[model samples]
Target: MTQSATRSGAPERVGRFELLVPIGTGGMATVYLARTRLIADTYRYAALKILHQKLAADDGAGLADLVAEAKLASAIRHPNVVPVLSVEEDEPWVALVMEYIEGETISGLIRAARAKGERIPQPIVGAMIADVLAGLHAAHEATDGGKRLDLVHRDVSPQNVIVGLDGRSRLTDFGIAKIDRTNATATGLVKGKTGYMAPEQIAGLKLTRAVDIWASAVVTWELLAGERLFHGEPMPTMLRIVNEIPARLRTIEPSIPESVDEAVAQALAHDPSKRPATADAFRKILVDAWGNLADPAEVGRYVQALSGEKLDRRRAQTEEILDLRARMTTVTRHAEASARDTSSSKKAPGDLPTRLESGPTTAPGETGFASTGSLRRPGRTRALGLGIAALGVVAFGVWMVTRSGANVAASPTTPAREASSSEAASRIVVFSSKRPIVAVRVAGRTVESPPALTLGVPVPTGAHEAEVVAADGERASVSVPADASQVLVPLEPATSAIEPSASAGAAASARPTGRAPGRLQPPAKATAAPKDPGLAPPPY
Candidate 1:
């Protein structure tokens, strides 16, 4: 993984898509949050991602690896792994549209915790590690035709993890990792975070499931120890990892048990076989070790010895306020992994798991679709989503039949073209924000837009309500009609809704202590209903 070069070509509208804002920049490409242009009458919201022109042109940009990661990750269904919502291959820059994670990194969380002179509780840390393992376990166990996929998380560290205020822990960034079943590493070059790298990994030895176990152990120690355990300072960190022994947990905190110290020391063992047999095993051990001591401050003298105040979402990480949005962003289930139909009839391949069940599976000229079997025709089956070509043909045919059957009584010669355009222009106009909004629809198709929002997308005509998803991975939809003009939607990390009550405290406070600027309102008096602050479209 060499540092990616600058992109070529100027930023310009590729077609009807509108680029929203720069989401982030990595060693390889600049990620932008964008929107797809909606039908002229239906201003529906859609997200589009573009590979930086320069990155797109690079032979080493590894398009195959990028697509492979998408395909692999798209198959797994763990809550922590961000899902790949869409993929567009043939383009100037191959764009991998995905369920964007809007939150900050675990590293950011650690930095915040340290600033507060408090450390994440051992149980929370253990749980966070467990979340990552659960994701890995799902990926590792994923099988295609009885063959185990045999996955390995090459990079497992705080930087790749995101812990949200909602108490959900997620594992992101699978692009750079490798799976034992499929060779995914970049040859002749090293990847993964230093200091967290296991002894075997540092020796340039081939990695296995054990490698991840070691990294997990190191991360667990970091969260519990409150400082870098391998080597605290500069170059020495990597050096001491190879030469010197790490300070024992008991030395740092006398209250620490012999088992906890031995467990960590054993996990850092030079031999992979000596480490915990699996991530699950390590998690169990730590969970037992942290039984009642989840919160360090509740413990003895060690708690007071810590300088910084124990803080949480509110005051621990001011720099991560923006990062919190990414972590807390909502999730959209549009790409629902289709479950096998419980019918007695013969089923199709899609009737089983593993197939990517996303978007409109309908054939040409259809409005609704069935997951299994062939496309159901107009009078036979209900399919959702048809292409413009087919819809146009149907529209033209319907117009012809209507014209032929119209009454002979006609009005005097008048400029009918101007009258039609004028009338259409005067119709109701509706729009929504980057966050999810529900719109009423008469049919699956959109009719005239309502006059609610001046920006965002207009709900397609004809439907009373449909789910609208944002790139950030959050989802919300309106069941009511667009005629309502404005909607009160719950939105977050990915634009989503904040429950009327989150945890025991948020219900009492009524305000997200760390929501984006003006994005949240102080919760009103005790009420069970979620508050909807007429949100303007996001400026992204």
Candidate 2:
């Protein structure tokens, strides 16, 4: 679509990769459809994603992010995730030769079909996107340590999904995808595609795995309804996300089954805690029952109704989901994939699956990813609740028993302040206010990219520090330490938490500019020293 991108600027060859043809281009880079010309045709094909020439300017922080993404993406190996083969920097372009996936984007498929007055098959659409969700789960769960890689496909939309000839749906374009735990983080412009964003992501809250699950739900909605789920050109789409309202599936596409509408509602639940916590969990909710988008006129009525008077599909669907969920059989889940099980935390009274994170708990009976819904004795709910409380005490005993003197010395005292708990790491310090601060280093540079300030991060030990670097790069802060085992550094209260929600509105105000970095002016200063991390003013 973008004219040839200049033949002169394009590379003749890259790491034995032939520049066969350019497939697509976005705000970040140009993707080329090409084949790998190895010594012997290993029967290889790959896509070459070359950084845009203008992006290399370093004027905006985008180039730095791309460079980091190249390194991060190349390190990850998964079938669902398009592999990054190699990276090289040319004079004018930073080129990355990657595994070229030969297929049409879901967006292209949708557009072609709509133009021809045709609709995509619902089951095929669901299957196509179901595979995409699997890929997201693989990336989200990928990790080298106890921490999750936490790769969030910020942009989960039709444009990023590819339906291959093999009928497998593959996800490409980590361009705007964010690896939350990585040392490098992207600020300024919002990451992710329009029409698909989680409420927290929309609010700029500390992003969790739940955000991706929420977005995946949106993408699923789009594919099944044969119409835009969060429809409203772009501005309205953002409002639709930030409004903290739930959308009904039946209204989005009347043909969708009632059971599916309920599942979709849970996936799109405004509260992150209410939504499926993991992609695997989300995938599990979707039985092959919810077919994909092949029905065209099914969604047309809703659009027509919108143009006239749309009914209360939004509110009705919410109640329906709650009613339908009552029929779902549920029991407390025992985590298996994780090394630590914190099922000690209790869920709010409800039958829907809820996530609970407690201080590290012990589980000698740990399995990689398998557990049963073994039931407890009937009419023993009160006793079971008491057991959980007692388990909290036992978990402490387990921690003390498992820890060695050296291990005790190595652990921090607080979530973000103390170097070691046993080493008297108990003094907690938080941002007197919510302001922009870059983490120069984290836990001897092995932890992960910490928040500008400690907000949602739980302190395993008593204290720890996030090395804050100054804006100009002239000097960095000595680590800001917090003594509390956990801290919540909320910047701007919930009322103002939502950014203007307009890309253009943010462009002039929050967009990284030619001036020095970290020039962001905090609207207010934090004062309350959170002995246990107190909340701060909402972020604008």
List per-prediction Cα lDDT, in the order shown. 0.47, 0.49
Global lDDT for candidate 1?
A: 0.47
Q: For residues 97-142, could you state the per-residue lDDT of candidate 2 as single tens digits?
A: 6665535567867765675566666666666656777888887776
What RMSD does each model have against the real structure?
20.8, 30.3
After superposing candidate 2, which stretches have Cα over 4 Å from the reference?
A: 1-8, 40-44, 145-147, 179-187, 244-246, 291-540
State which candidate has the highest lDDT.
2
What TM-score would every model get versus the actual structure?
0.49, 0.50
- Report the lDDT of model 1 for residue 500: 21
lDDT of 1 by residue, 284-329 (tens): 6766766643332232223222311221111211112222222222
